[model samples]
Target: MQKATGQDGGEAAVVGTDGTGPADASGLTGDGTGPLAGIVVADLSRVLAGPYCTMLLADLGATVIKVESPGGDDTRTWRPPVHGDMSTYFMSANRNKHSIALDMKDPEQLELVHRIVGEADVLVENFKPGGLAKYGLDADSVAERWPHLVHASITGFGTAAGAHLPGYDMLVQGVSGFMSLTGETDGPPQKGGVAMMDVMTGLHCAVAILAALREREGSGRGQHVELNLFMTALSGLVNQTSAYVAGGAVPRRMGNDHPSLFPYGPFACRDTDLIISVGNDRQFARLAEVLGMPELAQDEKFATMSARNENRDELRALMVGRLGERDAQQWQDELVEVGVPCAPILGVDEGIAYAEKLGLDPVADAGGVPTVRHPVDYSRTPARHVKAPPHLDEDREAVLAWLEGRGADCEG
Candidate 1:
């Protein structure tokens, strides 16, 4: 059923001739598996940051109702890697959820949203400062009405005196000093290869929500939890920032090399590169013996960790020279066998395969839709892949129908 969609966009829900969900829904699985099996999430955020967070919730068995704007989340059309007219960018973070489109500007739709918010156990929003208020869906106002709802907000900055500024992940990384510490210090500061700040913020938000839900067990009330990319980036640099604060040394980018450790980075082998972390003197000795250079461990310049750090350049050169006699994967296997923490640099595919071989379900079927597996695991109630990332408003009519039983007058 994959069709060619032009750059100009279209909505996600494919309405039947008589206006109901397809005779067979192509996307929605509704399997109800995993840890969050019975929870309901009202997702009112979009793009990577918000969508990623809500997607994590969806993966945990939450019935996530993705509230897209009438035009849909912008990434829905960010194509070139499109699948059946859906963008991979959209698919990357948005599996295991149902979509519902609404025009927030319309008063009737706003009323219906309030009804949905009322029934929601959790509500996640990433609207700009004061943007949701225009639609009467702000946290403070909504929480007042739904006392048990865990309302979570993802902002660029903390919602304080300075709330108007937009919160994009890259911008926060640039402004929060992450960019200054990335890449080479002498070279231009580079943004991370992926949207790491956003990823961290999403994870932080999920953690906060889970904590709030635990607290509500006794308190019998939900609290408003807020997370921003800036705060997440700052928190993620815990060790680095703590070192600077305590040691009075602002760390700069060292690239693949470890700043405080030697012989703990990528070294060129005969055919490839491998990373080896010699955590202690014992490990260093083991590594040296494995490389057939036992004398290097006793050498005055690299005897201790401090000495090795001081002579990092020389040690790296020696290690690389020895490593260059073997292939990266071969060195990896030997080092691992010898008890040194090591791995070869793997591309995405190789990484996935490696994870799979280790019995890690790196990928799983999202209701027959191929999707990456969820990161969380629970011993008691396992998360089930109930659904795949829904097409835009794929569940609109169905959701509306369900809402009818809730006794809320839906406006759409």
Candidate 2:
């Protein structure tokens, strides 16, 4: 049923010929297996982190009402990567939800947001600290009015301290010590290619919201859950941060190398790169044999983990010499068959294609567009998608109709 879309270039929503929802929408599920079908979410957040969180909730089966301004979310203007003039950046995270554009400065529009919030089981926002005060939509005010609503506040920092700082991902990465430990040791600190901080923060926010939802069921009350970009970045550093805090070992940039794990990085083969992960001494021994240097396994300077750490350069030089005789894929096939952990370096598109070949089905067809499928696999209740991301204010009439209608479910 996927056909040519309208001028908006969003994924086509092919309902019945009459243009209503599908004939058999017993609930909100496309495949009739959504566990969170009854829950309504008023998504007042914009841009990556917030939208990503709401999109995940929508995939879990919440009816998400995305509130955008007159111009829509900022990512809508991020261009160059376009799908028929649509902002692929915006599409990346805003799927499986309905979008409504409103100007908060307009009293009437502000009332519409309030109406949506009144019915929402969860409210997510990433407004600057106190940015929504003019409209009385800030966390404290909204929480006071709707005591049962789970209010999630995503901020650059806490409300009281560092409130003036902007919550850009790169800045958070730099300040959180992520940049300091990335890239080559001799090179200047570099930010990651993707906005990992934003992604991590969004995931953390989603988990906290889900937890609050569980608590609400027991206590019949909702609490304010707050997460910030910098804090998430700090926690995301994981073992690197632990080394500094617990072991007093300030980690430095080693490029693709792990500070303590030798032979656990990418190396050049005859034609391309293949990454090998030698986690333990056993794996190291197998690697030694694969390189046709079984005698190296008994060399006192390269036998054990500590020894490998001490002679990492010598070990790498020897392996590189051996790998130079075979192409990356050939070596990968041979090493993997023997239980060695390794893979040939692939581009993003190749990775997707490989996932498809492996039957992972990493992409979900929403309406007519393909989106990254939800990472979690629920055997009993699977994630479902009804439509694609909406164009700016494209569903305003339908949303307004639903809002004005006396439907407690907020199917608007």
Candidate 3:
């Protein structure tokens, strides 16, 4: 529940919505309470996926050393959303980690990378299948050198023929059939507003890496873990994919509508858009009553789950007709009081504020930087913020000094 004050007292390693790092660290590196306190991560991933995965690891109290190119993370230049030239995109991840720039094209710099990778407990990357082989950082090569290092790699695709293809999140979103199901039924396919696959892949990769690390506890050896945006997107399809695979159904775009559930997506009210996610017949009865249409519960055409789904359009028309008489908020308040799951559509800022209003504490201060709170909550060893995202290679001197102290025999 404590905020990260950062190890250097410079900036709390946090993704700040305010576009600034927290500069005042409370002078604590945690008392080694986080489950990952002594763990170390060598993060070399760029853009959203890798950085986000590593940032989550860092939040869990890992000493993540962000290894960047001489140009630093490519996101550093994704601008317009900049905090004094420091890309907010970059700040979105890469917190609570040490950073050092090592140009692999240079032999000496590559050597430094090897040294760090050798010492790190975990290494994360998002290069193409054969991308890191030239620098001798491939999973096979690193495994030979450091048998105890957990090597996790993220790719757009697997190491098959598609390995060379770019792994842009939007591309995966479309290619993975998400776009086909998004947007209005009559509109062209549309991708999610955010980097959906990238973040999903990151989350998946983190879980895999954590599982691998746990397995290593017994084997006394590390392993190579891999994930890709394409596979991740497909897996994330969840019920949509299940419907197709299990029932031989091909889902089409149904804007603001659920495939097998009636009144389970967004609906327009008198004022604003609201979501009425009715799950079962009971909730349907509640909703029908709330709308002063108790007859809906008795109507055989809409009495059961299957009937309601089959007649969703008819149901929607009836529900909307009644809902349009009352504003979204008024309906939301009434429905919520009766245990119906519903909410007015929200902006990102409003969502955060709403979480705060509900005591979720969605925001946290990392040192002086304002950042989103960690998504997980550990009863004993919760995630902690300790340092702000590094200013490209800002920790070069310190990291090298620490390495030098570890001596030439740092990692066997």
Candidate 4:
């Protein structure tokens, strides 16, 4: 129930009570008070998606052992933004885990990995479909050896026809039709700023792993959970995909505008742009009142959600003129006061500052490194942040000692 302070002096979320505080020198993995306190995760994935999924498990108090190749994870070299000697990109998804470098092709190392998988509650890997078959780490192989282990595999595409295609976030974005729906209506397709498809696939993989674990409780047996980035991207498209599959409509790029809602995108104010979202007719009426144009809400063309959406061009023209009369912050304050959801577009730093101001601690300390906190808050069992991201082969001795039954303390 205690909170830590960020370097900026802002209070962070409650920690320590459930073993969710900073790491101790004792080499314990977590406080064993988190939901997944006793869970052991064998992380054989690299880069973003698989690492990201296992990181979530680690945050929830799982003892994650990251098995890396001799050169380590690809993200280790993905730098320009480094934290000391490590890549920030690598740190972003690797906190709270132990790392041991091993050549998967070596008989000794492969045997060690089998032992790790034997003791793991979950095994996550993102190799090409059937890539691990040679090493006996594939889902079927692992399931045969460890019937109680949840085996999750991630690929760029499915195991069937698209297995040959490498899965990268931008490739999935383009192939899944996400890029087609981004950017200005008249401009070429665009990819998102971040690796959205990889992130989404990781989230989906986490949910699937959890579900498989829950099912294991009743059956007392584990199963294979397979996910692909292409599918995840398609599902993540959500309403856009629904528009095509169910409504027989193909959605296209419209820049920042919402296809079905008026006043849902950014509008220019006197000094800056503000995003105004008027979800329903009541909110539209309130927005009109705040704009000193109450009659606009009564007009047949803008009276209802559907009507406003139908005549968004005219409504946008009117709203834009009224919004331009004042600065973005002034209009945002007034509109928000009237229950209309609105805000000035904020940069990433400003967004974090706003979250801190709202008492939602978005950052946490992992050992001495600052990383984004887990998104969820549990009343009884909080997420832990006891370890910092490890350097390549950083925890080899400890991990090997634990794996070999040497009584090494590896988990809180």
Pick by TM-score: which candidate is best? Answer: 4
Candidate 1, 145-238: lDDT as tens digits: 6777788998898779658888877898898778888886478888887889888888888888889877876876778998888878888988
* Per-residue lDDT of 73 in model 2: 96
Residue 16, candidate 4: C-alpha displacement in angstroms: 17
At residue 248, candidate 3 shows an lDDT of: 86
Q: Tell me each candidate's TM-score.
A: 0.89, 0.90, 0.91, 0.92
TM-score, model 4 to reference: 0.92
- Per-candidate clash tally: 10, 0, 9, 1
State which candidate, 2 or 4, has the greater lDDT.
Answer: 4
Q: Which candidate wins on lDDT?
A: 4
Off by over 4 Å in 4: 1-28, 406-412
lDDT of 2 by residue, 385-412 (tens): 6668889987776666655442323332
Query: Cα RMSD for candidate 2?
Result: 7.0
Better of 1 and 2 by lDDT: 2
C-alpha RMSD between model 1 and the true structure: 7.9
In model 4, residue pairs whose N, Cα or C atoms come closer than 3 Å (at least 3 residues apart or on different chains), thus clashing, are: 156-167
| Candidate 4: residue 302 Cα off by (Å) | 0.4
The segments of candidate 3 whose C-alpha lies over 4 angstroms from its true place after superposition are 1-31, 409-412
TM-score for candidate 1, please give it.
0.89
**Model 1, residue 25: displacement in angstroms?**
16
lDDT for model 2? 0.80
Candidates' RMSD to native: 7.9, 7.0, 6.8, 7.5
